[model samples]
Target: MNDLTKIMVSKGGTPADITVGDALEYRAALQEHHAQSAGHTLFYAWLRRLGSLPDDAPATLRNPSRATGQVGIEQLVDRCDLTCRPVRDLMVDYLTERRPGLDYPNAGQRPRSLS
Candidate 1:
């Protein structure tokens, strides 16, 4: 298939308005990052780092709209697919298990207490 189609598929069918060359570069970067990632913590860290970049960051860092939470959503979707788990379920489980002190409104809801 075409490069555009390949990129779209690799990103879990998310639409990316990028040239074929850029798509290839992005694919390589994603593959490299995924390969190097130790686990979910590293993945979350990378997404947070991406989200914290200044608005005027370069194309590579700015292409994903992190300031508006788009990057986080994308990362969640990607992670869910990678782990073969439901997004809400995984997040709820993570928060409940990882941060036991937080107050979760419901068993399936996210933690509401953050200090």
Candidate 2:
């Protein structure tokens, strides 16, 4: 918490005035320094419990990197490397129609079976 306190004081704000952006910047600094402390998460939670954060503040300070979006049907089918063009198009259409109910792993498996 001393690190966060330093950040807050440097910005001319108290601990209660720390924003989500401030927390993220701190996390980035930790990453840059290859630090592996979970203190930030604890401190963020403490601030939240004291009602120091906005209602829209995230429940956790951990910002996991995830794939931006789902892969397209064409991309999924193309990965299968089906030699038959007509069969590839058919798989694409079939997967596109069924994609609403299927997850990525299941959708990916369907095209591989045809290969």
Candidate 3:
């Protein structure tokens, strides 16, 4: 909300004055500055509910990079730089088998542990 407030103030308006363009610009700024997904925020929904934004406005102000493909098990294993081909292949197979049971955070941690 602070970010929105700043934008609104800079534009010489209130929250009710925020537009879809403003929200999109904010999302882009977040992605460019933070170098990661902006995820979802309630401001868009709030603006829509207040009739400040169109009902057809997006539910999220997330970055398009949020839809990027997940890194593959092979890619994750390769980053570990295992010198032995057998060990590298085995680690990949292990991760592949375990991936179904693991959530994203746990799956991400597995590669770091390998290093």
Name the top lDDT candidate: 2
**TM match of model 2 to true structure:** 0.52
Pairs in steric clash, model 1: none
Off by over 4 Å in 3: 35-40, 63-115
Note the clash tally of each candidate: 0, 0, 0
Q: Candidate 1: list runs displaced more than 4 Å.
A: 1-55, 60-62, 66-70, 86-88, 91-115
Candidate 2 per-residue lDDT, tens place, 17-37, comes to 888678778788887899884
- Write the residue-wise lDDT of candidate 1 on 1-115 in tens digits: 3434545565554333333344436555656887531231232233335454334433343333443343433455465556555756667566556454543356777766543
Cα lDDT listed for each candidate: 0.45, 0.74, 0.69
- Over 1-115, each residue of candidate 3 has an lDDT whose tens digit, in order, gives 7676867876768888888888777767767888453433566767877888766566556542343446678877888889999999988888787776564545435533433
Q: Which consecutive 10 residues in model 2 have the weakest lDDT in total?
A: 106-115
Model 3's TM-score against the true structure: 0.46
In candidate 2, which residue pairs clash? none
